[model samples]
Target: MQGVPEEWTEEDGGTGERSRGTGTGKGEETMMMELTRLVQKTVKESSWWERRGIDCSILAAAFISLPPAFLLLGSSHFLWFSAGVLLMGVAHGIITIKGTHLASHGALSESQAWAKFWAVFFIEICGSFSALAGVKGHIKMHHAHTNVIGLGDSSVWKVPFLSRSIYLFIAPLAVPVITPLVALGRKYFPVERDNRTVAMVTLGLYSQYWLLINVSGFTSPLSALLCMLVCRAMFSVPYIHVNIFQHIGLPMFSPTRRPKRIYQMTHGVLNLPRNPLLDWMFGHSLINCHVEHHLFPFLSDNMCLKVKPVVSKYLTEKQLPYQEDGYLSRLQLFFNRYQELMVFAPPITELVGVQ
Candidate 1:
């Protein structure tokens, strides 16, 4: 709510979604039309990056595997291995953030068939996620419906009194443990195919990984489990944090309502500032760039980054909202104030302007 802009209001007629309010003045405010053209132009120029083959770079996995590979040596080096464990965490997280997202959108789909195979392998085998399942859940269900109650994938909405604090922050840390249950919940309770596949693949990956670690004659069973627990926990924490900030703390409309494309995107999705480290590692998947990814999903990570400025500028000139923040600051805010940010009703008044 803090980063929420005044120019944004919810349209209440059909499908309610947070939208931008047009000001009467001309000058800078008139740039919305120009901004839209720039966005279109930049995206058109970003085609080359999408065709490039980064996903096929198998060496990325081998290189990233180094830290985790060292831990499989089975030596009395827990202290040193601890650092490796964390690196493993960072490595795996980056792979998931970059690999799965790009692949899901078909941005890395140069080889089509091979790309799908590899992307599914990375998420299922490396990231311990089900490729096919999560893709649909995200691209189809979530992207199509941002912050729209049970429809949107925005993880920010929370239960009654707890707000987003406990649900978004603390609960997300438990995701490594909980997602399996989430998957299980879907399986038995009559959920979607993708949801069930996500669970099964998760179980399969971890089971195979543990067997492989054991076969290597690595540390005792206890140590191996500890390493895994830490690895999964570390990965889940940052990912969940990133997800919660993406589309929460905005507006949510009903089943039949919808917001203007730009306003819905501007208010539903947030930028979350820029971190050079994360930018280099995860690139366009990090912030409001994600919405653009959702929009022009065929663009590669590099191309997405290139077009990000154009999109951000489009939102700003339209007097639209674009939320961003330092990671540490947001983490602290999650612990302290995030809960209050969740679960707000649509604005009583409606705003104008639609195509």
Candidate 2:
């Protein structure tokens, strides 16, 4: 509370905390500036490993896990093959999910050139998605507009025509197949075509196919293809769920009447408690420390974890909302409310004072 803006402090006529829906312009600016300073100071004091080295280790381990997985997949034993497939799927998930996420946000490096390099490597070569589209949609649109109804409220993930069970359970399994096709179709692109994006995506798809047949020792190309699809979609259910559960049912705002960044993010974003598998697959930034990630997009996953206590405590002391929910709880909420939350768009929450 030491950094709480004087205008909104208990001494002033105003309440110690701004309501979730509104903040005075000056108070909002002052509050964010103070919080920004605190975050910066905390980040600056942290070591290099906390900021970047741990992610490097995580990426390296995921890569290391692949060779054994391939060996197991090639085995004559059914149990060994099954174990191998599971291992391979988990490794692939970690690399693509955690790698693409960190690289997309430039959390791996300070240099724009290195950032773009990693973005292409992880997103295009590993994830088989266009790096340009990923950055444009995620950083520019999603992060910038957050819970603004038409822009960043995870609307794109919804399919009104599909029943809840189909959408949640069956549909996501095709994500591995659909992701590149959607990118190629220019569904999310701003231009008519991007040759580099198309080429890299094609290369990634072929690389996976080649690996499945060759290293995984599948004699039949058709069998290899099936193996590829199954491994790739191992975590698709949670992947789809995480995308929506974090933002969709939260407080949504009208695009034209957005609140300050702090209020918008705190009210709109909800963090799921950590699970060991999810933590490894999606990085801490995407999981338990989502609010911190949205607030400090550049922070590495380790850095985000380090700052979680600071962020949660600061918000609490200021009487600002700090949204956190259980993973199972959110899953149940979505399951029960699918029709209301996904099939039809929810109304926007009108802030008390803005515009």
Q: Give me the candidate number with maximum TM-score.
A: 2
Please write out the lDDT profile of model 1 over residues 1-355, one tens digit for every residue: 1111112112311111223223223432344345546655875665443434443353276355754555543444776656666666666556656766655655555555665665555556555555555655665567666666566646433555654556654665665555545444444323564564665566655664665376535546666666666666775655767776666555555545555545555566666666765664565556536755544445666666677777766666666776666667666766666435555443321224432
Q: What is the lDDT of candidate 2?
A: 0.82
Highest lDDT against the true fold, candidate:
2
lDDT of candidate 2 at residue 338, scale 0 to 100: 93
Clash pairs of candidate 1? 14-257, 15-257, 15-258, 164-339, 165-339
The TM-scores, one per candidate, come to: 0.72, 0.91
Error of 1 at 213 (Å): 3.3
What do the candidate models score in CA lDDT, each in turn?
A: 0.55, 0.82
lDDT of 2 by residue, 1-355 (tens): 2211222123221111342234467767677777777887888898988879998899999999988998899999999999999998999999899999988777777766677788888899889888877876786668777888887788889889999999999999999999988778775454533777888888887887788788877899899889989999999999999999899888899877878777888888889999898988899989999998888776889999998988898889877889989988998998999999998889788656532
Least lDDT summed over 10 consecutive residues: which range in candidate 1?
Answer: 1-10
Clashing pairs in 2: none
